[model samples]
Target: MGTAATDDAGSATRALIFALVALACGHMLSTLLRTIPAISLDLMAADFHIEPQALASLTSVYHFAFAAAQIPVGAAMDRFGVRPVSLALLAGTVFGAVASGFATGPESFAVGQLMLGVATSGMLMCPMTLAAKQLSAARFGLWSGAILSIGNIGMLLSSSPLAFVVDTWGWRAGFWISAAGGVVVALAVFALVPNQPAEHKDHSSPMAQMIEVLRLGLSRPLRGLIALALVSLASSLVLRGLWGGPWLMEIKGLTRVEAGNQLGAFTLAMIVGPLLIGMIDRRIGRRRQRGCREHSTDRRRHIERAGGGSLRRTDCALDDGGHGSVVAPRAGLVLSGRAFRRPSPAIAGDRCRRSDPQLHELLRFAGRRC
Candidate 1:
């Protein structure tokens, strides 16, 4: 048993290391592509003989494609696993970046940007999948934060190192370098990332999974979160991708290189914000727990006074006699007069009967909806 446990631990460690690598690669690819707009905006404007405002639309075009691809890519990862899908997307990155380097007109440039967006879409989901499958629940937050921080390093490099590369070899040449890096990372993913077992596999087809993701994304808390993410991302992209460069160039009267550096600083702040917020969340959660404990004690005293001393020690004692009180230790209270005891077998049976069909119908509807 000990040996088996040791082997499991070793396997988990290996998987985590590979996941970190995958995350790093994803970050690097995303940051590299993200920086391309900032780095190439001036060149694109000159090459296309368009105003900066028109050039800004190209950034929107890329983000539109990127955002659109995420759901489908996530579905594909769920159904097909990450390896082949990731490699294929990386190939798109390579093709798009290299091709964008040679584009002679705005149309071709926009098309190339779209292709890059589609490619980069894989980066957002695949790494997270790998991490979810490999890392322990306790380690997930740490690994996620670390992965994001590593990825943001690519954003940092994009400003300075990319600028240097562009200065030495021109902007088009810098893209060629990114294309080559994509190819290399794709190779690394193939070599290092472990294949997930087919247990409890998604029997749904790709189209079905896509539909389900869309449906789930629209439902309740998930919908609310998705809406928030979309709104936040839209505002962020507008500020960073569309306006950051122009704001620096026009408003601040800075050169492209200087503006890129300033934008890089903003990206760095984004990387830092998650960690800061996580710390705050932990502190707040602790404080809430303490407050909840105090409130529970106060409520228990009140319950004792009301001839319900039975509720004092029980974790989730439910009073069905019109008092409408359920007391939980750490979780929250459900203040209804209904009995909150564990369901009897008959009740469980009834619930299963009702829920199973509803669950099946929901899944079926989702499969059809998206």
Candidate 2:
């Protein structure tokens, strides 16, 4: 039994690791799509005889489609598991990248962007769901951080490395390369990542769970967390998706290659941030635990002082006289039992007297008369 258990644990760990890697791949592809346009924005603008805003709209269309699909894609991930959904999305990404490379006008470019957005939506959620399902709670944080860091590398590559690819063989060549890579990653995910097992098949309807999620979000803490996440994500998206490349080219006056290199550095920093935060969290967690213990002790002491240096105990008593009393040992007083009696105090007193032999014997004649 022990050996079997160990083997099972090992299998689960391996699955979790693979899932993280697959998540990294998905993220890499998404980031690639995101960054490629920025690197080639100038070329795109000049080629299409449009202003920067028009070319930028192409990227925005992709973002809108990607963001819009998140909730539904999450639901699909819950129902069907990561493998099939991820594989399908990856295939879409490849097709979108290839199509975008060949697009001749703004309209065709927008269509490609929308397609890429729809396809890459799966990339964001599936790996996370897979990790949550397969990994132990203790390890989830580490794996999540690892996956995010790895995925950021894709963004990094999209910057400097993509610039190199474009510089060598032109922007079209870069897209073709990305499409080929996407296809390869998709194949890997299909081959290696585990899908939902029969025993763990989803029992609840997707609509029900989605509704529950909506309901839960109405609570204050959930709402707050969601709001905070949205704000942070908005800031990040604006910085990376909109401003990063422009800042490099316009403000820094760097060539596309030099600008891409600068953008790569920014992406590298993003990749490193999670790792640094993880390490800080680990270190701070230990300190936080100790602080919590000390705080608990201080709270206990404060409570003791508030009660005159002694803890108070309260007790209820029912006497033979058919009376109930609330006795506070610290206060040295007993509350009248009238409030506790369901019927008349007289009736309760008589019953209490009858039930207690010591009190009954002491007032036997009186009891008999009653």
C-alpha-based local distance difference test score of model 2: 0.65
User: Cα miss at 280, model 2 (Å)?
Assistant: 3.8
User: Looking at model 1, which ten-residue stretch has the lowest summed lDDT?
Assistant: 333-342
TM-score of 2: 0.71
Q: What is the alpha-carbon RMSD of candidate 2 to the true structure?
A: 22.1
Model 1 C-alpha lDDT per residue in residues 9-81, reported as the tens digit of each score = 8987887687567757866777777766665577668878988678787667777898899888877776667
Question: Candidate 2 on 211-303: residue-level lDDT in tens?
Answer: 654554453323333443443355446556666677678867988789888887878888997766544644454432443343344334333
Where does candidate 1 stray beyond 4 Å?
1-4, 198-203, 276-283, 286-370
